[model samples]
Target: MSIMASRPVPRDDASWRRRRLGLFSVCLAALLLPICFSGGAVATPAIGAALHGSALEMRWITSAFMLAFGGCLMAAGACADAFGRKRIFLLGVGCLLLTSLALAFSRSALAVDWLRALQGVSAAATLAGGGASLAQDFDGHARARAYGLLGTTFGVGLAFGPLLAGLLIVRFGWQGVFAATAVVAALALVIGTRGMRESRDPAATGLDWPGTLSFTGALASFTYGVIQAPALGATAPEVIGALAFAVVLAVAFVAIERRVAHPMLDLTLFRYVRFIGVQLLPVATSCCYIVLLVLLPLRFIGVHGDSEVTAGLRMTALSLPMLVVPFVATQLARRIPSGVLCSTGLVLAAAGLAWLARTVGAPDTGVLCPALWPMLLIGAGSAMPWGLMDGLSVSVVPTDRAGMAMGIFNTTRVASEGVMLALVGAVLIALIGAQLPDMPGAVAPDVAREAVNRLVAGDMHGAMARAPAWGEAALRSAYEHAFATLLDRLAIVTLLCAIVVFACLSGKTRSGATDTADLGEPSTDTATP
Candidate 1:
């Protein structure tokens, strides 16, 4: 029997109360993911300052968490189904509480990094188990609303995380940020223990151990290679070995998935053209919107010398559109074809990126004024597909494989975010390195490279100390030049992705109908979260 079918329906008033309480607990736990994600970015410079970490070490503060969270999500979901959702959910929340508490007291950057990775593993379990629990508890309209609230909770966390973290940091230092998440996690644990029920899939197969290990290893290896390249040199033996190992592990993962009885990822899903198009939506947003959540904070607080509070307040322009624009896009999807609506939104974002690139480095313009409109445009544009992609993930696939499709789509969405963050940081570092030699008061090539690494790592004081010849003004100018170039390249990439998405999605339908007919599936109330 299916998992949901096996669970007895709640009939009594007390059972319903427990279900509601379970959902609140799940949502409470869900809020921690984004809070940790965005808040970590704001906390990184401070962490480095306090811990006396290097550029690559400082990057790990955020990277380790994201990479671990993304890599383990599929495995976590499988475990949730094979064991019991409530069992996994409680374990996850309990671990999260422990990790957050540990992070608050950690003395070293390396300790924080390792703890962050553990925290991410816990988060993956929490999300996978909590989402599965909700799926089992609700059906039809109720399921839709439950997931909707889950999505909104995530949005709220992303929108205000920096601001909240900034306030906490100002009042109580970096530890306050982790302490805040720990407090919320404690609440989630208490409620979940009191209310959540056990449920599991009777027909679930053995976990894909090989696939899980290989996939996680591949992502970690690849991200490490990328993030360390600028510091270790592209030709360094360690960088070369890591990249080569990543390729081998990736090949092994695909082979394992193809051979396994119940694969973590069904390779067959890639055969669908629309599935390919749907997956691109996340990649597009990762470039245009998600990367900014990390990079912009570094620019404002680290490079431009704004206070953490000012930087967080400035970030609201980039994140606030997430709260309102997705609803507008959903309403418009009823009239416009999904492909067109999505492509148009990307086009707007591309234009904004290009605009921001041109204006961001203008010396005379004020900090917030130069980037404000572009940030709004990019946020609003990216929000167009944010709500619809989840529904499209299932609708484009056969009904029997909808579950696999959703899992794959979410994994791609999240895994790509971690990969892109690493890739963009690498690219920005390279661009900055290239600009350093040409600036006035330039130092030796080796010294310049070290300074660039420190600059991009969000250690402005350390960077200045490294290259005393290049005053703060010259260092900032070079960084501004490199940042503008990086944005231009990102804009081009986003535009190309838009074209590919439009082409793949155009003139396709479930029953040989127009795009508008199929588009309605994603707009309906019954759509998946």
Candidate 2:
């Protein structure tokens, strides 16, 4: 069992060097993935225009990546644990390098869509392996510091992605963004391959393919159904069929996991109330805040007539605070109870959203000055629980099961984001329809949906041209009214969720297979398991 016998590497200087190298490699992956995601958001319009992609195809460009990434995350986590985390991490970096290069040259929308999906799959592996590696390599206070940096990296990538992409797109077009990403991935691959030592669960055997397949099917079908529902009615055959299939697959996945000897996920993690609460923080944040990365750019470009670069710069208000707050949270953890900090942060975020909602409906609301204060509040508030949640997710599980635990935690974060996007889109489209009940002509619902879609995609001119019967002034008024209404409802729901998160973490922090002593003191539990 000696380190020398198993891997046969020098232990004196090489050990610390390996750890440092591994940490950087993982943080680099964290940094790059968000850029891939949010950069694509900034580049989507140009990509669609150049490829002559239809509205549906454009939607798929983002949806497909999210669907694949979320669906494959847990499976990738399990694979990393069974195989070597280093091997899996290297594989992911290699896949990303190749796919990003391919994406840069892709001329067709369909090709771009598929390439993005490949990138998503690789990203899933990279995140899972990288997180698991960090969890295994560092423990106690060191683990806290490492995760804090990881969270900061996540914020930097997410916050600056659009600004960087705006510059890239302006200078060299959308392809330049992907080309630059490829260079980063290539460097990670080389460092990770040479520096990362192999680590895995020695007791692990073969993968539980049934659980993986069922879970993948469930996520894919559900995502497709929800995304399509915004365009096709919820009752449409494709939507209904996909939803039904997703439900069946979900049930099957649960059943299979329960019976499997080595399940991809440990369902028992849900038994810990505090663990469940920690996981939900990501879901709540993604629904209430992270999704704004996509929505705000569209609002600025589509409704406000701002250029892409201008929109990206304006968003610095929201993202800049996110970049700094996680490091601050690391310091605050020594004094404040994590539970209290998380709840307070969520409530603050809700208040900010509420303020933004009220202001968005104003007659003369402009983009920057009016939005800056609220966006800052939202970002600062959400950053409180950001990295602490990651630390808690791993700390609450058995050491041997860190990979599965991280998989479940991150899967919850990402899948919820995708689901929220679809649900919000559906709500927005339905609200638009309700706001404009009758138009001048007897336009089909499909036709009306298409027009609204164009408006949402930042094509006010196209939307007006398509709906000539409806006066431009009236159409703009209706769309803005419906958008404001959507924000109002979202604010209410986010506030309620904040209360739920507070309640979940208010009681005693139950002990699990692993100790959470580092997280701080807690009250006695009042609620029964």
Candidate 3:
């Protein structure tokens, strides 16, 4: 296999460049995928004064899509394997276009909520399918580079979603963001139709309806419970039922997956210590990554009296790193093991979070400054693991079962992101409830603060406008406390990564072949078509 002895490999620089460029298109498509989640919430405060939408309604606009998007990955991943990657990708893009159009024309909060959910579901298919395609499309070392490129695109999309939305929103209003996103989705569909080739694992058959149904039901119930618990109250019947149903469905799903011939989700992957630990990445990522962004604005308003426009601009710090660093890190990871990079990135993120946590008492401008670097670290760290794990995940499964393996990966990433956010959100609310004050003319201080929480949580604009005499100051205190509580979120992520690597580094720190060997090699692993 000496370089000179090997047969001359053909090279097509133009095609190479074109394929390289395909990565960017995927990123552009991803950029708006997650943006749909925050559509109403991000828009509400900035224009709430003008639009007069309820804060609760806006929050739903932000969170509802996440639930739907996460709830469908298992099915979508299987769809990619069965129908073919490029074709399914087109379908996803088509759905995204339609949903974005619907969102653009949404007249009321409810319509926006439903459309956002649809947008999220479409985005989920795109995320899972597009990612899987990158794997099937690239070969050898090129695969790693493609992975990095894909990672960069995802990071860029997440980072730019807010910035782009902010600009369009400012220039043409909120609907502008929707319209622009629709155009992007429509263009993606066209490009995919023309250039992308279909990739279906010929051996991948036996669609797992039972597994899909059971897992979907379980996850849907769980996501509903988490999203609704805050608004529904602890004892609310819907929340309780959702939680109970989730628990039962999860147990049933596990039992079913163990026995089903072609299951929606296979449970044996968990036995691979590396996959199990890496799985935690999603939980940590979803819980801590966006949770603060969700809450940080309250700090800006309460402490510095900054407008929503200003707060959104400042968030560019977090978004920018998330976008830029992945492009850099993904390249470097070709040489460096993802674990070393991941550990280093987490340390950096922990430092950033620690600094951010310490600045809670400072001015809004100063307090948020600490977040910039950690945001970068988080972006890089997030990309590093995926660069390694995804390749490893795909390669380990038997060729016939590749679709199932990928489906699990996609389902876990989205589902955990949603659940983790809920976990951290609950912790933040429980710990930082002290910062919120009662709205105008409330009786008990605690109840009043909860009301403010409801208000801030509901509509900071309206809350700020009708706040009690001590509202601003009280809200500031609540934010300070919340920031303090955010430390717990960071600490959890840091501790989880540290513990997993320290304990299981021997398992996950190896090459793909090594991981497969250690995991007792899956029964039906396959090669690219």
Candidate 4:
């Protein structure tokens, strides 16, 4: 029996044309999802400068979107299956169009943060519904090809988003970033409206409301506490309360998932050692790679005084390997054990991070600086598991549970990215804050704290304006030190993850099979929604 579903080919040429058009529409919409994620980080400095957003508000501009997107993703897929794929897809595109347009005109940071969250929700719907619709429209070989193209489109967006946003910002300012997203959303809406066919799963057990709410609440609360910790002190009542609430909700979510007839996440899957190893791949990448995508842009544009275009070009070096290295990793897996390949990749990334930390503050000569090699190394290293994680996600579980396995893997990947981004940003702020008082010409304690907030928020000009005592040179030096320290910590975490993943996957399975046999051929089906 084949792993993929089989569907009858459309007899008429017109039906085929419609399906092709639907693929293009969904692919276009899918492209915007990563752009929204990566581009927001590129635009953060400009947004902070224009809106005069405080540290917390600036963090929310990015965090709010990510949290909402990750929290709503699994539920959106369930809604698509239970309700109607085309209906939800169109609704998502329409809402995205509205939110993007609103975001383009918004003047307040708070308003932008709220709008970005809505955009995240809309993007989730677009991804889930659009993907499910494609699964319905084609199957077998055609399904594989369509999904392969969709995945490539997503990769392209992630790789080039910063560069594109930088070009737009340079020419039309920050609003141009949102304006471009709106244009893309509008095109997707028109094409999708004409081409998409409605479909729903007959056996769908409906949305898991309790589990969804609890999981979302837990993530949002935890993220809130982390992002606010620097500003409100870790022991502040609000911070402590939010953390406590998040813990309670997380426990509730676990209980709800165990009790529900159709849980969004099947917790029992964790019993498989291989499954646990596969899940850790994303967490590893998030620490070593994904967090850097956001932080590097901020550091280049804000701390280092690099232009948006320059920062974007620098980021391209970091992300470009993702477009090519994943394929190379897949081929290498034919000769090497997948576990060995994954752990080796992470080790390389850890080395790259360590190298990067040492080179970041060096005088920037041009676009290609000393940091370029480290960025490329990190990208190449992380791409290895990036290629295999999807296939491993499904293969580790029983074939009948492939869809559930895919969902859990993706949720772990995305949710971890969001959480890590928030945690790292908070840590960076704390690290910078700690360095401020010790600087040669440090200001008063209160003023130094405010400077730390502004500095971490990517408001370099504002920070200097607030604390002239700590001169531009001293401030920059402090930021460089803090950023390097954060990178070192991340490197250590990645190395630790690599060790655990290797152990979990290197061992023989219960069936007395070597893990390398599970590598097989890479799955062409899209595991992400």
TM-score per candidate, in order? 0.93, 0.90, 0.83, 0.92
Clashing pairs in 1: none
lDDT of 3 by residue, 1-529 (tens): 5866686545676556556555555666776665665444456454444445554455556566766777887677778887887777778889999987887776777677778778777887887677777777678988877766666666665665655666676787878878887898888877666556678878676467776677778877886776566655667899999999999998988888889776677676666565565565555555445655555554453345555456666666666666556556556666775556555655555566666676556543443455566555554554445445555455444445555566677677777766665665555555545555434465444444344544545344455464455565665577567767677567666756755743443433344453345445542334221
Q: What lDDT does the true structure give each of the candidates?
A: 0.87, 0.77, 0.63, 0.87
Cα lDDT of candidate 1 equals 0.87
Clashing pairs in 2: 302-458
Instruction: Evaluate candidate 3 by giving its C-alpha RMSD to the native, one decimal.
Output: 6.2
Which lDDT tens digits does candidate 4 get at residues 143-241?
978987887888899899999999999999999999999999999999998899999999999999999999999999999999888777788899999
Measured with C-alpha atoms, the lDDT of residue 377 in candidate 3 is 52
